[model samples]
Target: MPLPDGNNFIEKFAKSFYNLFDTPATIIKEKIVAPNQKTYPWYHQKFRRVPTIDQCYTDDPICVFEADMQYRRDRQVDSEILSILRQRFEDCVLYETPDHMEKCKHLLQQYEEGSTDWFTKYGDLGAYHDVKVAYMKQKHRMVWERRHGPVGSGMKEN
Candidate 1:
């Protein structure tokens, strides 16, 4: 059958346009797999490698911020005694308005001592490095578990 005068060009153009986005048909083939062969389902993507923790990048702004934040968090946790003493001192000062100078003196002393002890223990580069290392280790584990399933689940590792 002959296409109408203008319909032929329009039909050809429309077909070509549609074909631009259409996926090409693939030929199906049969394959024989041995019993020992391992194959993943079609939906599964390529194998992913286990996550690794990299060293801290001091020059990078994002890395610097993360490292500093981690250090401060760990330091705060380890200095729980200092934080308690400081909070007590603040509470005393806030409660005793007029006699705070004398009434809160003991708390002030305790807070100062706690602060000194904390500084002596965890106020150095060694402490910061320790915190960063521990944080990175934890992040690596969490990322690996999230990407691949839990360890010992028989997941293939690349």
Candidate 2:
């Protein structure tokens, strides 16, 4: 069905805006996963710990996996996808999993340029990757400074 007059503008705008956010990553995925793998590398288009059967996406092929093992226990963000990603990096620089944009730069640089030293600077723990992602997670989680007030809601103390 066709939208009529001004009513259609909102609907059209919404579709366009959604595309603007989802397009860049998908386009890059197509480029990087082509030839051997040519499908979306996204599972549900939302933040998830593991990719589902439906995602059918190949992991990023550019980064080289590491053989040495490094493990830490306190962190809860350590999903299998994260470990798999760890193996994909030469220096084990898998800062953000499930798509983390670098502040405002490439919006899709993935690893921190040639090195994974970014982890030493800012280890991941549901931190903001960019404005868009921050907005989305904040919108979804309604980020609070603490559970009741003081702390303990996965927030830092200060």
Candidate 3:
């Protein structure tokens, strides 16, 4: 269908003015090709830019915020793994009493190994980040599947 012709002076003038520009198609194409916030890493997504470690530590607010968020998440994962090992070690030590040093030695060693290993699991940030993001995606998928039943299953609600 043809668009309606502008009926008023201002509308006609605006329409004619905008029609003078012939770059809307290219503008739209550029927008479609641009890297959006969703494509960025979760931590620094707001700024749509990658910041170096030096920038993060040197008072760049966006970088600082991203670093802080990452630190907290890393600490949380570390704590979850370490706390379990720590609890087992403490329990073994508690029960062994006089022989705790010798009897609980293995548990102590495991705890230490776990604590150290957590940091070096993937040996690099890129691998660790990929795993962590994959885990989050899986967790969300599981939750959604639980609520709606598996994809392609006939039990989903409308």
Local accuracy by lDDT, each model: 0.65, 0.41, 0.66
- Per-residue lDDT of candidate 2, residues 94-130 (tens digit): 5554344333234223333412433432244344343
The lowest-lDDT stretch of 10 consecutive residues in candidate 3 is 45-54
Looking at model 1, the pairs that clash are none
lDDT of 1 by residue, 73-105 (tens): 556666776778898999999999899999999
TM-score of each: 0.34, 0.19, 0.32
Measured over all alpha carbons after superposition, the RMSD of each candidate to the real structure, in angstroms, is 20.2, 23.4, 21.9
Off by over 4 Å in 1: 1-77, 131-158
- List the candidate 2 regions with Cα displacement exceeding 4 Å: 1-7, 36-158
A best-first ranking of the candidates according to their TM-score comes to: 1, 3, 2
Worst 10 residues of 1 by lDDT: 23-32
lDDT of 3 by residue, 70-122 (tens): 55556566878889999999999898899899999999999988876764442
Ranking by lDDT: 3, 1, 2
Instruction: Tell me how far candidate 3 lies from the true structure as C-alpha RMSD in angstroms.
Output: 21.9
lDDT of 2 at 112: 39
Better of 1 and 3 by lDDT: 3
In candidate 3 the C-alpha lDDT for residue 126 amounts to 57
